[model samples]
Target: MKDLIKAINGHLAAEFQASHTYLAMSIWLRKKDLAGFSSYMLAKSNEERGHASRMIAYLVDSDETVELPT
Candidate 1:
């Protein structure tokens, strides 16, 4: 169970980082006036955040102490 929690946290951390990258790309695209691409990337970033939230919630509900990745 501890191992599972650790793995989940690790995955979430990676996902969160990915969200950051996506957001950056979105901002850049918006600056370039590519609204469509920017919106798509922004949506993808939101999805990643949602996934991280789900991972955290699952770990907490499973009675695991989830240490959010640094």
Candidate 2:
């Protein structure tokens, strides 16, 4: 169970990083006047955040203590 929790936490971290990168890309594209690309990146960023949220909810539902990354 600890291992499972650790794995989920790792995945959560990756999702957060991906979301951050996508958000940056979205902003950059928007500044470049590429609305379509920017929208696509924004959507991807939202999806990554959703994935992270789902993992957090799962951990909570399992009654596991969530050790947030510092």
Candidate 3:
């Protein structure tokens, strides 16, 4: 259970980073006047959020403790 929790948290951390990356890309694309590219990056960010949420739900179902460290 502990390992599973750790894995989930790791994935969550990665997703968090990816979100930041995509967000930055979107802003950059906007400044470049590429609305389509910006939208694409935003979509990718949403997908990462979904992936992390699934892992989190699985960990919770397994009765593992999930913590977000600041």
Best by lDDT: 2
How far off is residue 54 in model 3, in Å? 0.7
lDDT of model 2 at position 56: 92
Predicted structure 2: clash tally: 0
Candidate closest to the true structure, highest TM-score: 2
- List model 2 lDDT by residue over 15-69, tens digit each: 9999999999999999999999999999999999999999999999999877665
Q: What overall lDDT, based on C-alpha atoms, would model 3 receive against the true structure?
A: 0.82
lDDT for each residue of candidate 1 in 1-70, tens digit (9 for 90 to 100) = 6787788888988989989999999999999999999999999999999999999889888888777767
* Cand. 1 Cα-lDDT: 0.90
Off by over 4 Å in 1: none
| Candidate 3: regions farther than 4 A off | none
| Residues 1-70 of candidate 3: C-alpha lDDT, one tens digit per residue | 5776787787788887887789899889989999999999989888887887887787778788766534
> Each prediction's Cα RMSD?
0.9, 1.0, 1.4
Give TM per candidate. 0.92, 0.93, 0.85
